[model samples]
Target: MTRSLKKGPFVDYHLLKKVRSSDVLNKRIIKTWSRRSMIIPEMIGFTFAVHNGKNFIPVFVTENMVGHKLGEFSPTRVFKGHSGDKNSKNLKGSKNVVRKK
Candidate 1:
């Protein structure tokens, strides 16, 4: 039976049940899969590439991995500038903003 669960975002119980029933998920015992799964990797990958470069710079793609506007709230280095004054301000006139240890 489908049981409605109020996870952070709207998650359907049937879907959760199906995922839990799956061998892979059950084996791993994933209690509450976060929405960051797809995004975190991309951000890390971008960070890695930047770190490797002579001048590590954040480059926020205009669109996210899904090809839609990456929300200003979304953690990314690349700024679309179009995201508005705030986003543009967040990524002002410098490409090589150094990171602190």
Candidate 2:
């Protein structure tokens, strides 16, 4: 769900304060766990280390990312394989010629 239009985008209070105080050119790398926070226009060109459960993922903000959640850029789950069980047989149909009696 999106935030209320009247309240505006929901940005982290601490993150907003830091962004406001620092110079645009000397952008401070921000590490945050608040993935629900929205990317504001002021955040463009800034680098953010967004937490994705295990580690922090570096994200460089751009104009295109505005109004989106910081979490959208960070991935939580990783899909390694389609196999359901490790101990289960992977091959359904295969030749067993070597076992011929």
Candidate 3:
């Protein structure tokens, strides 16, 4: 569900303050744990280190990311892929198959 338009976008006060205090030309990464905070226009051109449970992931904010949640860029889960090696064994045996060139 989306936030109520009347309440406005949910931008963390502390995060905003940090962005304002830092110089954009310095290229310093602003570390933050507030993944739920929404990205605003003011955050453009700044790099953010958003916490993803175990570690912080770097998220470079651009104009296209405006209005999106910070968490959307930082993934929480590590995809190890599906179980079973049956497909791999079959593929190895089929290497001799003729190909349409």
Best by TM-score: 3
Candidate 3 C-alpha lDDT tens digits along 1-101 = 88899999998899999999998899999999999999999899999999999999999999999999999999999999878977776774687777789
Sort by lDDT, best first. 3, 2, 1
Cα error, residue 85 of model 2, in Å, equals 11
Q: What CA RMSD would you report for each candidate?
A: 17.3, 3.9, 4.6
Give the worst 10-residue stretch by lDDT in candidate 1.
Answer: 44-53
Winner by TM-score between candidate 2 and candidate 1? 2
Q: Each candidate's lDDT (Cα)? A: 0.34, 0.87, 0.94
Off by over 4 Å in 3: 87-101
By lDDT, the best candidate is 3
8-99: candidate 1 lDDT, tens digit per residue: 33333543454445553223323222222222222322221122123333333222443222232234355666544655556656776776
Candidate 2 per-residue lDDT, tens place, 1-101, comes to 66679998888899899778877688668889989899999999999999999999999999999989999999999988796765447445546434637
**Steric clash pairs (candidate 2):** none
Per-residue lDDT value at 71 in model 2: 99
In candidate 1, which residue pairs clash? 59-78, 60-78
Error of 3 at 93 (Å): 3.8
Candidate achieving higher lDDT, 2 or 3: 3
